[model samples]
Target: MQQKQTPSALDRLKELLARAGFDWFLGALIGMILLAYLWPAPGVQEGPLSLGELANYGVSLIFFFYGLRLSPEKLQAGLSSWRLHLVVQFSTFLLFPLLALPWHALFKGGSNELLWLGTFYLAALPSTVSSSVVMVSIAGGNIPAAIFNASISSLIGIFVTPLWMGLFLSASTEGFDIWQVMGKLVLQVLLPVVLGIVLHRYWGAFAEKHRQKLRYFDQSIILLIVYTSFCESFARNMFRGYSIPDLLLLGLTMICLFFLVYGIIHLISRMLGFKREDRITALFCGSKKSLVHGTVMSKVLFPDANMVGIMLLPIMIYHALQLLAASVIAQSMARKAGVAAEGE
Candidate 1:
């Protein structure tokens, strides 16, 4: 028999990074943030390629492609799991806000009000579609349900997130217009999505074939938005008051928030007697927040564009942490499921 060779340290590191999702644009995200800090001038809206215009078009395209890929039959089939869907939506829109609201009360009259608002914004956002579906599928979850819940969550958030923000922003800020925000959302987001769904019958297969490349396209748009937002913020010195310790604390808080939701979903799924797959779907779909929606919505919601970077702080942190944590959990669950199946 031939002896098997041991993997080198480099191979081990690569495996670890892959498992944790670090290899999947996480490094690029961090690099984008740093680039924003260093040489952010070109990313500004005034520059060529016009970061703002490109991001606007990109957001529409991203959602259009999303709708194009979704199958109505899959959505209809997943609708049977009403209980699972309710739990996920409730956790996302209700529980997340409830959890974040207290943080505002706790930190009331503090210098971190902006940060608290950012947290609330994070909480109010919907669960991510692609990552949630990917994580659920990896963990052997009910993927159709994941897809349905994630997609619907985005749709619901288009109306709900602004309503939630309006309540607070109206009282605190000078110009918070609900109708203006809704108009933009309808034109840019809803219209494109509807168009894509209508066209899906013609191009669905083509979309599926090119989804890998499309995913990169989606990320590129996000990076552009991030770089632009942070550049504007840096130019205005919005990050001046923030320090390393503040960021570290925010990161820790995000991790705690993630686990709290994850644990709650797990408990609820068990109490409701969900099968393993449904349980996995609920836990993942409930715990996630969409950075895509957060970024897109911030452009409309916050009139003071400079503060957009501060608003996105919680979102960016939570996005990275959730991907890392969810990937690890999914891998572990997959391994155990495999072991059990083999034993059976």
Candidate 2:
């Protein structure tokens, strides 16, 4: 028999990072930003080969695929968990915005105002679907409820996110027309989703079968959007005001925001007498913000391409931190549940 080779230090570090959710996708996000910094001209160029235009089309397709995979039966079956659904949705749409609202006064008329707006934008967005469900599954949560809440949250966000942003966007964004934004959202996002759902009986299986491929498609589009947005920002010097300390602070704030929401959801779950699985679902589903929606919607929400990159910073940080923190928490929960099972 061949001797088993000892795992090297680099291998151990890679394993640890993987366990913490530092995957290729996250690395690619960083690479896209760097590429934007170095070679932004390609990303910002308009015309037939415009990456921005391609990303817009990709956003519509991403939502269409999302609707395709959504099973009506699963949604209806998951409806029985009304209380859990209420908690998750309210935590996502209401609590988060409220938490971020009070800080606006502090950052108003200051260098960090844009950062605050970006943070509010992050708060107003919906829970991410794929990662939320994945983390919930990893933690042995209520899968049906997780699916239900994540799906419903996305649909709710299509309306509520705009309404939330409207309160501040009108003052800050030039040519900020709510009706126009709504129309664009309907045309680009809602219509595709509706079309996909209507055709689900025919193509749903195809979507589900090739979901892994579709996911790659989704990531590619997101990367394109990120690159283009950052390219515009860099071209216009939108990031000049921000320093390393400012970025470090924003990242720190993102971590705090995640834990604060996570802790609050956990307390609420216990107070409401939730079982372990239900609590897990609430915690994971309620604490996530959709980077997909953030980037895509920024195309419509902030007309100036320059502001889009800054707008995305908080969500990007929050996205990475949530994934890393949630992965660790989920694995710990899984291990605990397994040990309990063995004990029993």
Q: Pick the candidate with the highest lDDT.
A: 2
- Candidate 2's residue-wise lDDT over 221-307, tens digit each? 999999999999999999887999999999999999999999999999999999999999999999999988998888888877888
Off by over 4 Å in 2: 1-21
Error of 2 at 32 (Å): 1.0
RMSD (Å) per prediction: 2.3, 2.4
The superposed Cα distance between candidate 2 and the true structure at residue 134, in angstroms, equals 1.2
lDDT of candidate 1 over 146-206, digit per residue (tens): 9899989998998899888887888888888888888988888888888888888999999
Candidate 1's TM-score reads: 0.93
Winning candidate number (TM-score): 2
Model 1 CA lDDT for position 32: 79
Local distance difference test, each candidate: 0.86, 0.91
Pairs clashing within candidate 1: none
